[model samples]
Target: MQQRTLDILDKVLYGLIIALFVVIPFSEAGINIFAGLILIVLVATFVITRSVRGLDRGIWQPILALLIAGLLSLFFAADKGRGLHKFLSPLVKYVTVFVAVALTARTDSRRRWLTAIMLVTGLISAGYGIYQYGWLSIRRVYSFSYNPNVVAGYFAVLTALSVGLLTGVKSRLWQFVFSCTTLLGLGATVVTFSRGAIIGLVASGFVLFTMLMSKAKNKKAVLVVSLIICVVLVALTPDMLFQRFRQIADLENSSNRQRILLWQTAWDMFLDSPIVGQGPGGFSAQYEKFRLPGAGDFVSAHSVFLQVLAELGLLGFGACLWLGVLICRVIYAQLSTSDQDLEFGISLGTLLAAVTVLIHGLVDTAFLRTLVGTSMCCLAGLAYSIGLHHKDESSETVSP
Candidate 1:
């Protein structure tokens, strides 16, 4: 009876995880509801089985530190009540989903299912964005989000993941699916006209190509083919997109100037409360006081790292760095392993996905949005699980 109950709970946990991934790209409310349920189910699983085999300390430790830092920063916020709300809703919620998914999606089969879901949903979203841009005469496609930039960042990460999967998987069918997903994701990102997203996608693509070349049997052939593809893609790109890229350096561009002002404001906020900072949601609350003379009214710092530093101070920033370092360490270790199979491809893809978020985050608040942030965290968790599982199997084999 106990064994049966545990099996049932495990099934429930897996179902909830699937549901969470399905709704992630569509609705923030869905994320909240499903994430909450998953957490509850995860806790129940822990209590029933009295086991924490897959939940690694390396994964949770930095997250716990960030949470603690955010909590402490709340005391220094301009509006403590709002800070508390911000801390609980997205900050705490993101952490919960990350840990829960890592624990539940332990096996290769489960992780592959989740990745397929993400690719399908991402493709659908990208298709919708393309339809809006071409048929509906929309200037910028936002997809499911209100802001085009947010959706751009989301698509950019998916693009990197698709590329990673394309190179990693052995199956031709899966490769074709990822190929379509990658192209559509790139198209969706272009329609959004977000320079930051494009820059990030390019950077991550370079990293992916480099990694692939390192593992390829014929390096010269790979390099030549990659160059040819790049040239073809560049030739096919629309003139309008090229113009948008040029605007990144245009001083006359209002958006570019505004972002600079917002970044400056974030710096001012950090200077004011260097220790703990202004707390969660502190940037918007204290924006007026720190706003540059000609800067327009805005909420976010427009940069993830800057916003974290401004809100949670150096301590919170350090915690974030800690988390990033740990994730890189785990993924790198996994990539170093001998097996270059589907799981290896996944680790490579997730690591590049993270690179997209971090690079885009430098120019836009990519990681602050719920969908993008949680999605990246989910991928990170999956990568962590893969690394740990491989290590355990190796240990068992060596012990015998």
Candidate 2:
């Protein structure tokens, strides 16, 4: 029963990895909700018939709280359609991530392979950004729902993950691929002209610095390459990058103004509703009606943190925070341990990058949106794999 349970969970995880990396990216494929449903069913079956691992215990209350929050939000939501879509969609996605990671995190070797695939996909995704910059100047490449800011933030996180993997690498060949992938991803980050990406990149670097200080392995090499990358990024895109950073200092800029307004609007909604929010998807639609005629369309709350708070209120926001802290603590605990080298480093990098993206989320909603849900899920899975590896290794060490 135990062996069969492991085999089933392993297949579910590998299947998820392949679907996200291989099937989703190469074409106009939507991540079928059916796949997630099947996986959940399988998990339920395993828990019922076999002795399941206890890793999922950490996530149980958080997931339950999020679901409860989502359900409660429906009663107060101004727009039921928008609320249902927004709340339910993320609820489903986050649950998938929690289950997938908890079940499959078992071995260091498995974690390495997971990192390999995400980094490789990051490179391929960067190709689209490159195309957008060069030939797809027709504005169709990243238009409407897929704006430049979103792409920049998304790839910024990707670049950080790739860099983390590069540092985490053991083999010479893998190390070379990391360098190539980082350059390509960094190139894509440049083209997006996303100011938020720069902030995320900086935050991710700080996390990397913490890792370096703790492990203190490759000091000179990390410093030299990092300096060179920083110089080139600044020198190459001096105007666009500098202007965005400057906007942070000078809040008079239009983009800065827009973000403030969106935040204010969210605040207004939350203040009025207080206990219950304006509803999950209701923010965009309701916000536009209050704006002047002929004004631009307001699609999102801009900040994921505010977006959740405004829509779900204190209860929902608390649940989200709970889940986030659990994942971070679990992964960081593994990374901080002195068990394995490459696998620990990979998990450290992934968790850092994932946390960086959440920080980016405070400014942008790339992962929270459906368009990029698969990408975010894959990143979370990568982090979970890292944690699982450590758990497996520690168990092995104590077996004797």
Candidate 3:
């Protein structure tokens, strides 16, 4: 009876996760309520069972470390209330979904289904973005997200997922669907005019191509053809897209100058504390004293690494670094041990998506927003969980 109850909870959790993505486009309140419910379920199930089944300790350690670091930083935080409410709390929620999915989606089929759900949801979001561009004639379509850049970041990850689905799934029909979604997703991302997202997508594509061709029979030929195709595509890119790319090198662009000012202010914030820094959620309140004239309104460091260092200080920075290292290690193991073609393709695609986020983070706070961060965290946890299961299975096979 207990086993049956847990099994039912597993399905419930999966459904709720899918619902979270579907509701993301419609309402922030809906997403928040859904996340709150997920947390309640996670806690209640754990308390009732008195056992954390499928905890995936290896993946949990880095998360635990980061949590501890955040908790400790609260003592030195400039605004403990803001830090706890705005920064730390959301992070905790992100981890909750991560751990919940890791524990629940322990099987290959479950993971694949979750990935499929995410891909489909992404396609829906892309459709909305396309509609905004084609029908409404919005200059930079943001869809349901708060801003164009956030939507771009979200689509950047989706573009990678679409590629993963196209390469991993064997069915011709599914592949065709995924391929079309990939094209649409790319179009949506391009229409956002988000330079950071565009660069990140290109970088992720390169990573995916390299991973896919690593063991191919004709690696050199594939590389040559791929380079030629890339060159041709660049030549054929829309003039508006080229104009955006040109802005990357133009400091005279108002946005670029503002970003530089923000960076300078962020550095000043770090210099003030240097240890725990201003603490989580302190940037906005503290940045005013250091703001330069004509810098425009801004609240964040705009770079994930800089934000962590400024808010959490060196300790938080170290914690984030540790998490990054652990994630990469787990992904490497998954790719190395994946015995099936589908598994390899899926793992490779997931890896590239993660790389895209990290690359995008250099220029923008890509993961700070609720929509982008939550989805990325869930995907990371799922990937790590799958890796652990596959590793254990491989060990069992070799033990005999």
Candidate 4:
């Protein structure tokens, strides 16, 4: 009976992950918040049971680490209340994501379903971006989302997921789907006019080609052909692509000029509060005092690392670095293991997505909002489960 209950909980968790993507577009409508309540309830029940069982210790280590850092960071924060709230707000949902994916992905089939769901959701969102950017004449000079940077940030992560599955997934159909998703999603990302995303995509592509083709000599040519296709497409639509390309340069772009000011101001904040720094939420609040006279609003540090330093100070920076190392280690483990084809592929895909976020995060505070927040934490669970289950034949978590 206890085992059965776990199985049901796991299913609900996976279901919620899929649902979360569906709700993201409507998140501002108040409906998403309402839906989040349901997810919160499900998570509470699972945690209650799992905590009682005392088996959630290993599964929740990342959460534990971050929680500790958040509390510790608050001690040094300029605004205690702001620091504590910002630290805790995103952390709570992320913990739930870790629990959900970790518990659900103990099986091969479950992992695949997760991958498929990601692909489907990404494809749909990409399609919307295309219409919004192209046909509707929405003028995606900056971003399609509430912010243009978020579009790029989200795309970088999504593209990594699609690319990861290219080498790991087994089914020809799924591989084809992955390929389609990559092309379409990437195309939409460029159209969103997010140069930051473009940089992240380039990093992901480089990583994907090197990792996938380094071993398979025959596939090296395939990688070449794919790169060529991407180039040709961009070249053919240079006008469309150039619209995005134009704004990246400080010399040629007004936005670049503004971002430079933001970066400098962010650095100033870090310098002023080098140790404890301003509270996690204090950056924006205090921006007006330091912002350049001509620069518009006082916004966040566009760079994720900079934001971490400004908000959590040096210790929080160290903690995040440790997490990055651990994620890469787990991804390497999945790549090295030989037994399960699907799990290996899913792990590869999931890791790439995480990699995308890490790279993009360095350039953009992609985690400042909830959409990326939920996605990142869930992917972390997926990576963790892969590492844990690789050696255990008695236990498996489904994903890929």
The TM-score that candidate 4 achieves is 0.84
Pick the TM-score winner. 1
- For residues 173-265, what per-residue lDDT tens digits would candidate 1 score against the true structure? 988877888899999999998888888888887987887798899999989998998998899787888998888879779988998999999
lDDT (Cα atoms) of all candidates against the true structure = 0.85, 0.67, 0.78, 0.65
**Clashing residue pairs in candidate 1, if any?**
none
TM-scores for every candidate against the unseen true structure? 0.94, 0.84, 0.92, 0.84
Once superposed on the true structure, which residue ranges of model 1 sit more than 4 Å away at CA? 1-6, 45-51, 338-340, 395-400
Which sequence of candidate numbers ranks them by TM-score, best first? Answer: 1, 3, 2, 4
User: Taking the tens digit of each residue's C-alpha lDDT, what string does model 2 give over 1-400?
Assistant: 8668666756766666555554434332345553365466556756766644545566678978888888888777878887887665766665665466445545555656665666666667788778876787733234222567666655776677777667766888978877788778777877777666667777888778666766657788777876897777667774756766767867767776787888887877777676667777767857865453333567777888887878888888898889878877876776656355565555666676676677778888776754345556656665665555556667889998
lDDT of 3 at 200: 90
TM-score for candidate 1: 0.94
RMSD of each: 2.0, 3.6, 2.4, 4.1
Q: Which is the winner by lDDT between candidate 1 and candidate 4?
A: 1
Clash numbers, per candidate: 0, 1, 0, 17
The Cα error of candidate 2 at residue 60, in Å, is: 1.1
Candidate 4 per-residue lDDT, tens place, 29-140, comes to: 3324533554565656657585522223543465567667667767766667766667655655556555556665766776667666666765666788777767778767
Q: List the residue pairs that clash in candidate 2.
A: 105-388
Error of 3 at 178 (Å): 2.2
On lDDT, the stronger of 1 and 3 is: 1
